[model samples]
Target: MPFIVHVLGFATFAQGTSEFMLSGLLPALAADLDVSLSEAGLLVSAFAVGMVIGAPLLTLATLGLPRRAALVGFQAVFVAGHAAAALVPHFGFLLAMRAVTGMAYAGFWALASVTAVSLVSADRRGKAMSVVVAGLSLSMILGVPAGTLLAQHADWRAAFWAVAATTALSATAVLLALPAGRDTTAARPGLRTELRSLAVPRLWRAYATTALTISATSAVFSYLGALLEDVTGIPERLVPVVLGLYGAGALAGLIVGGRTGDRAPFGVLLTGMGTVAVVAAALAPTAEIPAVVIPLVVLLAAGGFATNPAVNARVFGILGETRTLGGAMNIAAFNVGIAVAPWVSGLAIDAGPGPAGIGWVGAAFALAALANTLLDRHLTHRHRRTTSRSAPTAVDGARATTVSLYAGHDRPL
Candidate 1:
């Protein structure tokens, strides 16, 4: 199970590195392609749009398939997309290939979460999920910076080729590590039934919280390189190193965040969100102070990345029998935020580099996330109270054949 988890993590590591490395290489890509930076920025946006569109739809379409086959197939698609990106000469074709890559990313991310849960016993589910999510965090910490270094020394094409190679390696690892005929059909639920789960107020609140949190993080992160250059006057050669440091903070936060989630996910989330708000506000005024800037950036990255596992765990916990679909939707919410943030922040940057303006943008989004978190907590508390008050009478009237609400649903192992 640990080996299987590691293999899945490697695949996500490759995917995430490819997706985010674009930000660091935007200037190189524009220079090579003879396009404006804005045009190159579209490549990032295109991938996010693909994820937002593909996650839930593809998950639903491939429902009931063997998990191993689905995993392999999606990764194969990703390899093909990277191959296209590596070989394609035209800018238009490259953008199109990125969209295809995004679709594969959505499939992989959704399936990876569901598969991670299935691989573990009920008591180990949280650990399993964290191990998988840590892959993404590691990519941010290591893979993106490594890819950026590769792009710096070689051509941008080298980075894409490296991504393809990593995907192939990860695909091979997964094939060898996981057992044959591992079934996911038993975990499948009806689409309508899964959709109905979203109608629960608590569920929407969770989704809203996830969306706002992601939007808040991405609003700043999508432009982090630019922010470093423009605000802190960091040398271009140093941006990757700084970004790597940010990724390091994120990796550290992911580890600490998982342990924190086990104690109290909601409490952790509120605290993280509040911390982000304060960090963003502080960042706005301290860009010139490296002592202040570095720590603030670390805090912002740590707080934002830390919230991910807890939020995911909370949503899946509420999902009961529809954990797979629910997990996919949460991922969808995240990608939607990614898609929206760059375009919005890009507009802000294009308007003028006020430097501190980006921090304010980040701050505003964090405030919104804090609001949503509080709202979710309130609603969840009220729902629990109402359920406790009515439980006995409802139990007396229930049919004998009624399914256990939590039965067969993947829970923390």
Candidate 2:
């Protein structure tokens, strides 16, 4: 990986910390603002909503800007939001600040994705992505936990201020480290032409697959702490330990998936999805068995995260000149997964399956993702076969033009 890739990952660590740190600070925030716990919880939801909308919208807004400048600009917004949130006493003001910070984070995600993919050669895109994914995983393991500790020792506002300071430093690193230019890997056509690239069904399928697989994982993950406490019978302090182990699996799986996903995208998808499905389904029946459930938690996180690099790499592979927009779309899809899955999991809990229901429900979603992957592979192979069978006819005038287009002289993303 390039040095700049690591810088991008480091920046991600700073921004991603704020993404999940709200969970740890919710109780304090509620008491400080004199609001209901449920109302304070909306602050997290506001961020998710910002992420979902900001990805595509902000990506497009900065479509024509220099990559480094856009990243720094987003970082500025992120820092400002955090600083404002830290000072603001009102719940509504803090909520708005959280949303603005989320938008900044999502925009940076979109730009950083395209930038990362562009930095590496085609074959190593997945490995490069793993570096960035490590930032996110590490945020779970290190950053959020650290923020929580800060909130414990000091104040929740201290945590917010910490994120602001870290984010500013990250932006400075980006300004110094990354080059001041747009992505040269893809041509910048007019806005309409760029939009046209997204019409490809293959790209949409890739995005849908991303959303579904992640949603499957989150359905289980969102309630994992509760399940560990209620069903697994683990001590309260040990719950974080198990969760930390799960976080370690994400970092560990980065190496496993990063090394292999470049050559075997489908293999990673199948194995990862299959592992998650099996582990999740088994968790329901074995919830009381600590020996089984503990390992399963680690496996679930590893299996789910292992697919992330491959998914991003596949998106870039399928994209045409609209790599920026496609990256944004996929980022939007990711936030969709994060936002929607918890709600689905909550439904399972409400319907009387209790915390154990998340496992089976997640299993079902994983299977659906697996099936989608199989079907996508089938269609892709069929298309390749059909195209090869008619390569001879591609030499004839109109056919030649169409063949050229299909082979990417002027293709869809």
Candidate 3:
């Protein structure tokens, strides 16, 4: 509810726009730069690689800085990267620029989560974090579509220039809005500490759940446009509209997920993953039916995104004060899943399979995640019970004695 949240939202919007706008402009980039589509695709791949490296590295390096300052610095880097991309004529130069952008983007992305949590009481943390992340959904819904339109009407360079301008504006806004203070007490846990924490069975289970969920969703979403055309008989021009619907569904899910996360994170996660699996499977066979296709696509979008806030909350809660690093690591896990899913789905598609293969793959991933979630719940419950039973009773006895002394009347009420 703070004005700073708006600034963070806008910064996230700019980051998301820059990250996705390239997809729409890929053809223009390929034609103008005399490169293949594959080469153009490297722009995306390069960004992912940067994210894979940048998330943890930047979080670690900037561990001591104020969140506001870190965010501002990252946004500045993002603006510079986009500016370079707009001006660079060479494909290799553009790729490098995009990679730099990804690095900057990762820092901002991770910081945003930490900032959101730090700004609010523990009770509102999930909703606060969700509001910032909702910027991502907004980007998919509004930014990507608008950027694509800009590229179509003007040159693709226009899109990058627009994003650069947006990034600059967002950077200025964030710098002006967020309070200036450092959190020196927050953990400076090096990679060794982080690794040890991650080695915990419960944490690994969380990672597996996150990975599976992302793989399931990305496997289908990566090729959704093509799938719609082949299976749903949607025209190329209408694919964007359908995708927009999907984004809308995701936006709705984000809001709902945030509100529900506080009371029932695990429940939200379980229901969301289960719903995603069921919807994906159902949609597989009915892809030719427009009515079914449209609703199912929406369901898939909702189910996939609805789990995000809950997952983030759970992971951060598990890591406590070390959330920034943990959040970034979880983000890296999501990206890893994104990288793997498409390849897995592409192989199936290439083998003369239909879009249905995507559903099967997604379902399998969801089931794996579900299994992990159940195992995690069991372990957590067991741990709680064991701790309750094994904790020294003297501590409780001392508390009782202290209470009796304070009451003075000393008759056991």
Candidate 4:
């Protein structure tokens, strides 16, 4: 509801554009850098590696600083990284720049969600988080395509230049609009206390759920182009249209999920994961039918992403005082899924059933995540019952908090 929250959302939009724009420019980048396609592909991996490492590390390092300052600083570095990436003559230098860019993005990514939610009340946390998260889905639907068009119409370097400019603009906006405030009180915990906060098994369950859910979604999407052409008999030209529909579905899902998540965290997550598994399994049998498969693709995106806000809110609710570390860890888990899912699916494709079978692989992952979600619920309930029998500390109260999606209501959220 705050103007600053929207500013943070804009920052996320800029960051998400940079994160996904590279996917569309790899071919042009490969040609310009005089490298093979596979080599150019490594840049994506490089970014993921940086995100996984930078998220928690940078989040922790910045804990004592003002939230507004950290945000502006991160975006400034992100802009510089893209600008450097655009000017680098060699592929290695560009790769290094992208890694740095990823680190900057991770810092902003972790903090922005927290900053957004911090401005809202407990009942509205999911909605606030959703505003920030929607920037990512919007990037997939809009920014990536625009970047691809820029690369095709101009040079790939032009795309990077545009990204850098956009990031700089976002940084300026954040600097001008975001208020300077420490995210926490004067008694900031030491690094050891922060590390101890992450030791909660319930938090790890949330992390695992995030990782596995992302892995499922990424596995299917990473090979979607191939699946569309090779298996669905759709021409290559229409793939973007189909993918665009998928993006729209994701945005819609995110909106609905955010609203539902505020009401029923675990229920929404379970339902979303179950939908993903069902859609993925159905895709395995229905890939040959474009009409059926196309809708399924949209459903897949919707189902997979609907869990984002809920899972994020759950982590925030459970972490309580440790929210910063918890948020960073969750972001890292997302990147872990992004990095791991495609690799696992690639292995599956290379081993046997070809590209179409990626659906089954994705389905298996969704099912596994569904199982994990069940475990998380069971643990939450068990912890709640245990804590009620004895005096509970702050951390124990947080751990025992009910994160159930439906709570007690059988009616829809």
RMSD of each: 3.5, 4.1, 6.3, 4.0
lDDT of 4 by residue, 124-161 (tens): 88889888988888877877767766777788888788
Per-model clash counts, in order, read: 5, 0, 0, 4
Q: Where is model 3 poorest over a 10-residue stretch in terms of lDDT?
A: 404-413
TM-score list, all predictions: 0.91, 0.87, 0.85, 0.87
**Positional deviation of residue 399's Cα in model 1 after best superposition, in angstroms:** 15
Give the lDDT of residue 108 in candidate 2.
96
TM-score of 4: 0.87
Worst 10 residues of 2 by lDDT: 404-413
| List of clashing residue pairs for candidate 4 | 264-405, 265-405, 266-405, 267-405
Clashes by residue pair, model 3: none
lDDT of each: 0.76, 0.78, 0.73, 0.78
How do the residues 19-135 of candidate 3 rate in per-residue lDDT, one tens digit apiece?
655545665677899985445656666776677778888988887777777888988888888877778778889888878888888888887877777678765777887888788
> What stretches of model 4 exceed 4 Å from their correct place?
26-41, 89-91, 181-192, 226-237, 284-289, 352-354, 391-413
Better of 1 and 4 by lDDT: 4
Query: Candidate 1: which pairs clash?
Result: 122-412, 122-413, 123-413, 124-413, 125-413
What's the CA error at residue 157 for candidate 1, in Å? 1.2
Regions of model 2 farther than 4 Å from truth: 22-44, 89-94, 179-187, 230-233, 393-413
True lDDT of residue 155, candidate 1: 80
